[model samples]
Target: MIYTELYITEEPSEAMNYHHEVRQVQSASKKKILHETPIRSQDIFKTLPDQQRPIRVVLTYGVAGVGKTFLVQKFTLDWAEGLENQDISAVILLSFRELNLVRNQQYSLLELLIFFHPTLHRVTAEKLIVCKLLFILDGLDESRFLLDFTNSKLVSDVTQKSTISELLSNLIEGNLLPSALIWITSRPAAVHQIAPTCLDRMTEVRGFTDAQKEEYFRRRFRNKELSSRIISHLKTSRSLYIMCGIPVYCWITATVLEHMLTTEESAELPKTLTDMYSHFLLVQTKKKQKYHEGQEMRRIELTRTDREVLLKLGRLAFEHLQKKNILFYQEDLEQCGLDVTEASVYSGVCTEIFKRESVIFQKPVYCFVHLSIQEFLAAIYMFHCYTNRKTEVLQEFFTEDDKGNKISLEDISSLEDFLSRAVEEYLLIPNSHLELFVRFLNGLSMKSNQRLLGGLLGQTESSPEIIQRVINKLKVISCQGKCPDRCINILHCLLENNDLSVLQEMQDFLKSDNKSETELSGIQCSALAYILQMSEEVLDELDLAKYKTSEDGRWRLVPAIVNFRKARLHDVFVFGGSIGSLAIALTANPSHLTELHLSSVSLGEYAEDLFTHLGHPNCRLETLRSVN
Candidate 1:
């Protein structure tokens, strides 16, 4: 709940669904935020002095957990306290999760306001028309109503009765409340629902900047030493550092690290995402057990009833995650055998994994602390299902058509095939919501994580043979995959399994004089590309022809040259189409190549084909050597 300022910009992000964005944003941890204009919460409803019309409807989009909801809440609080937006007479902030529950109900606009806020019951319809009101509708991504802008009935009267969907659509379209300000928040996937013609401005919320991340821990903890230790530990791992952009992730890190630093336990500090989350889960459970059950537990232990609730919650997480449904209802809870009054719903100390939103209505709403937690729980449940021999649950899931491909759950008896197929299924789609979940799944397969959650996960084993198979399957998938995103994900899976063989071989090949002993595979070249791009140091020379790989494998290494000062591409093919690896590097914003040594490589069929990037503003090429 420590509110820090997020990087809000005028330029909207082009990310897909939430988890697809979670994976993609790591690439930007090293790049500059390409926002054309930065804005504050107060500036969202303001019109510029460029002789433009008044900005009425503002559609704000951001990735999940980027602090969109918190920003709006703070904005409302500021307005209520007369600190900002003093001109506005009233600000009514309604949660979309709560609103989604009553999507089918019919109500007058005034009645709708009174339903959510009973204090507004005294304010008559006569007082509403004269006052300047700002209606902040949060979480359009979780909305259930299909807003038919073209077909929904228009209701201009605030007293007129209509479905909630029509009332919102009409209000946004300016038929109901032309003078009132409308502010809506949505994830990138649902931003297209509100057309450009209806919106006057668009804003995107980015996660914590590098400076803001440090400031957050300092603000959260009074002890400077504790904050410094936490920050130092996070910087050691690239994944942990990049993921700190999300405010919730920052909280998760604070919870796990602070517990370890302060406690008397001699557990090793977590280095991976799975390790952090696994420790986090156990920590929360231990606190709950010790407080509620009256006995302090050791390193890691879960009671029988605790394991039952976890598996039930995991089932809920698994079921909704596949449907991309973050928000859950009372029925969702009951379906998973979770009673509203049960100890599992004990909101006192165990709210991190699952909790409910405030509602005086008959129906109760539920959600995990974050999408990542939901994904973590979902991964645990899926693994549980596999280990418990609940093939029916997984079979029902894999039969559906995902994105464009039909995913078949056949011949996946082995642990390697089971995980590889899941990764392959998600990779076929442009934006895989399961990207983070699959990463968790791979990480949970490790002996360390399995030992922590053994009671709940049944008896899933990761023998040396199984681990090698998973690693081998990941490398093979990377070579066959067409999308660079998928190939990068394959590498991530390798990292999750604690297998650094590909990277070690690449380093070995670099150091060895007799490099002919072993040739780098296409996936290994891709892995080398990842290592080069992520490295803090710059390379002086990169000779693609020196490393022995196939023709396609040579192109796979093109992204690595972005770090090189002098790149030697002798007899290399730089062309368009799916083999657009050179295009990927040359168009790189921070390309640092000062000299090029392409002795016999093709520049392209035309000057503007691929070599035109040499004239780009970001390009720093000063020397060219082509003896051919």
Candidate 2:
């Protein structure tokens, strides 16, 4: 009953305010029109001449909780009134979420068109096709058709691009449907791989501008006193304001303020995103407690695994909260340890409060109605997961050394018995342990200890394998100097172990003349310095001329110098000699070389003279260091 009333609201402010909390409709269509124009008069309304020609489709996409659907609704309602005299036949607003419930089989576009209107005869449908019907497809990224819930797959095997493309193709090529102007909305990731031909124009719906935020705040709070207070609160709350780029965050913040005023609680308002969400979650918990009471409460009754899953989801939400982006797929969920055959971990939690009038925006592939809820959940998760016990457990698993002893594979397997089981359990229940595992491995790779590196790389489990696979995948790409700084440490580990296979693989990675060149150069310089000690012939095979010059004719020697100097040893003169040649070449023509590194070089009298020449202002070397 609560949800039914809320679903019928016409006033934007009233509908959004109490829709989720109380679900009460305040105005009818007639009253809403008289009170305020449902559609803005100044909005653009361009008419197409014919319905037979292929109509241009433009799509706008962003994250969930960013007021995308609301914007579309507002635009359509306004457009219909503004273009009342135009020959527009009808405007159909179809949500992918609604369509998913009725879709059991792979129905064609014609079948879907007919299915939505069973009363219309075939002749009427044909005539309607000739008339210009504006088709607004909302939430393409959330389309259930693209999701494999039963199999934990995100992308469809058909490889026809997006559902919109397939639908458009059916209508245009098959001649089953009319050439209608199609406007779509989806999250960024959903439409990322979609081909350019699918849509005529693609615009991104950015978060509310500051002016829009001010307008929204004024619209929500009629009382000048309350409005001023709220504005002050928002201004002081930097993180909350950043989160407010999405309009839904504004609504959530208003809701919190409204509740605070009603309860006569003038408690300190949250200043940061973490604090804001923490407050929201605490409020949610308190509200749940009032209804269920103690042990029987659904919030309190959540399993440890369930709680962990929620926390992981929360952490992800917190990280991307400022961007107001949601609508991620199973692969995205997998990164957080929630990849499984069952409904997503967050959706499952939503299911527990099914009777509540919560405005849940669901699509099969992605979930979450508001960015605030995601942030709230993420903040709670981070708070608990970073506790001392979990930290220690993560530290031991990632930091402990596993020397390459002659232990049997079976014994090693038994020792790591928890890994497969943990992964399996996480797969079934959906938790943040996998994300924690990845973060831990990432952190460990940054450490100077070879033992920690060996421990992480020695693992045979799927989780650890993913880490290696990621590294291997990264190796193939062009390094844009943006490759993780921690990767240098890993390369150092491989060099110290004399792992020629990894060294060769790294060398092959550096040879690719793609976007990752600068990164590969640094890795190469480090690996090659060590390799040169064993065989200077490898240096003869490298082509160093490519990375020598920037676009402005200035020489860039940071990558080469850093790696070469870091690997230098006091007694290793051969390594120093080979590096000196590369450094000398880098410093020769460049007049801006500020940092010079002969750090690990066992410099002879000749190398010292070379260092002095390189240190000159005309030579452009500012800080020069020679170990010996």
Candidate 3:
């Protein structure tokens, strides 16, 4: 009965754009659509009100574009509107992608809380900790980076290890704050590390059912006189219907059909998704013609080759959008083996064809006003980017290693160079490869080996500089910037000795005029905290607990705790000594335990004793983990 009206976007302007479109839809629908199926989520929604169960966490997963967000919004809005009492304090809907800018920052959680509840006080924040708020976090996979937080930076000798699973464990187990009814939505790959214990229920968004899809199609054609020829074509298009289960794809298909029908061109109906989109773009271009002569002349001049180039560029741009890359590069185009000179001719054709239908970046990057168009372009690319010829090109870009015939370092370096070049060229096409390149960067960063970071940083000796470069590159890719732990670990490699000067540099950088200062500062602080905890010596000088608290007073490390608990440690030692010694020292004098990370400390062998001691009624330890 209620539709949550939160429109997720990068900026306020974008949000306004989505808001306007949604408003138009609302105005068109005078009555609610009939409830075709029983509300499957009602039972789940009801549990949120059960004080005894105290439903603090719920996870909903669905295929992309299946309307998971829509359902969640609808449920939350309905609940809010129906409330007779104000006991349901607030309903906050957050898109993880939008919060990425503050990722890995000390006050990120605080920033998010304030962004949603500007009037919330420190006391209210604490009270809400136990289940007073309904927080819906959508699109976890959209986050820019995956972080591991159990590692230490103070010591130069061994690497620190952490995982997302560990972090979730700590949050639920620590019971440091009151829990809230939290809902998370993600694609399957995003929740691989989610602890089973943290989840109360899981729902999959299966897109529109067959009946819904039929109803949707019927609604579009109810008033229009349909030709038997088109109806027959539609009846045969099973794959098209399946794809159209997603609303955006349905819109694209409908637009294509409408154009074909108006032009009396039923014979030209597309048989495949790519052809459908191609036809759509071509028709869209023709609609802008001032006269028949101009339209005919332009259509005659634009060859299939030109269309291919435009479609390829569109696909690359779509990838960039997916990766959240905002910057386009010239080399990205070249990597596709598309000559700039030829691409320029195609660009000219697209300009004449689409006219005001699309927006062209200053440097020739063509961007569709609707993201659906980009999605259409990407679908086309996936169908064609890999061919026998392209496969050969990839092979030529790499050399086999002598050991096990694996890809050599030289080959990896070459691939990176090739990707970089491709990214540069794609950028020149005006918003072309920006999104695709960003996705590439995200995939590269998510690699387990850290080789990508090393390559990106090059030989830079300055740890802060390296971190800054990584952050800057990530921003270019439009990553959510939520994973500070990875950046902190990278910093550890460069700052082996707990160098005070490096710490000072990090502090100075945080204060400087950088876009990612907040996120970098968070990463630096976490790294510092990790180091201090690892080396009992440094923990004595600084107050680590202060950094853990934001001005708003909400806990900053809930997510971090979840991550620390899911990590695996091999031959790992905590505090350079046995777990008992470290615990005794930390509990004996709290000030001396500024940083306390015991992740992967073989704690299972002494779990009962450690928990008995660390979990004691009078324990003074602020932070300690058995696995990261």
Q: How many residue pairs clash in each candidate?
A: 0, 10, 51
Per-residue lDDT over 1-628 for candidate 2, one digit per residue giving the tens place of the 0 to 100 score:
0000111111111111111110010011101121112222112233234324343566665545555676676666656787442555666666775665554554444455555655443635347656777677788755656532233323222222234434544332223343566666776445633444444544445456566667777888788777677777887743355556566667767766655554535465655433344344444444533443322211133445645555667555644432334455556567766654545354444432111221223323555555335534543343233322344423322332223233222321221232322222222221121322222222222212112112212223234454454344323322222212122233432322222465675466546666234443434444443333223121222223334323111111222332221321222232222223334333322222454444344445446556455543235444555554
| Model 3 Cα lDDT, one tens digit per residue, 1-113 | 21111221110111111111211121112212221122344345344333456456666654445577777766676677874324556677765555444445433243445
Q: What TM-score does structure 2 among the candidates reach?
A: 0.45
The lDDT-based order of candidates, best leading, equals 1, 2, 3
> Each candidate's TM vs. the true structure?
0.81, 0.45, 0.44
lDDT of 3: 0.40
Evaluate all candidate structures by whole-model CA lDDT and list the values in order. Answer: 0.75, 0.41, 0.40
Which ten-residue region of model 3 has the weakest summed lDDT? Answer: 9-18
Those runs of model 1 whose alpha carbons end farther than 4 Å from true positions after fitting are 1-15, 33-35, 49-51, 122-127, 291-299, 347-349, 400-410, 478-482, 504-520, 528-628
Say which prediction, candidate 2 or candidate 3, comes out ahead on lDDT: 2
Select the stronger candidate by TM-score from 1 and 3: 1
Q: Higher-lDDT candidate among 1 and 3?
A: 1
Where is model 2 more than 4 Å wrong at Cα? 1-55, 79-85, 99-104, 119-125, 144-165, 172-178, 258-266, 288-367, 375-628
- Output the worst ten-in-a-row residue range by lDDT, candidate 2: 1-10
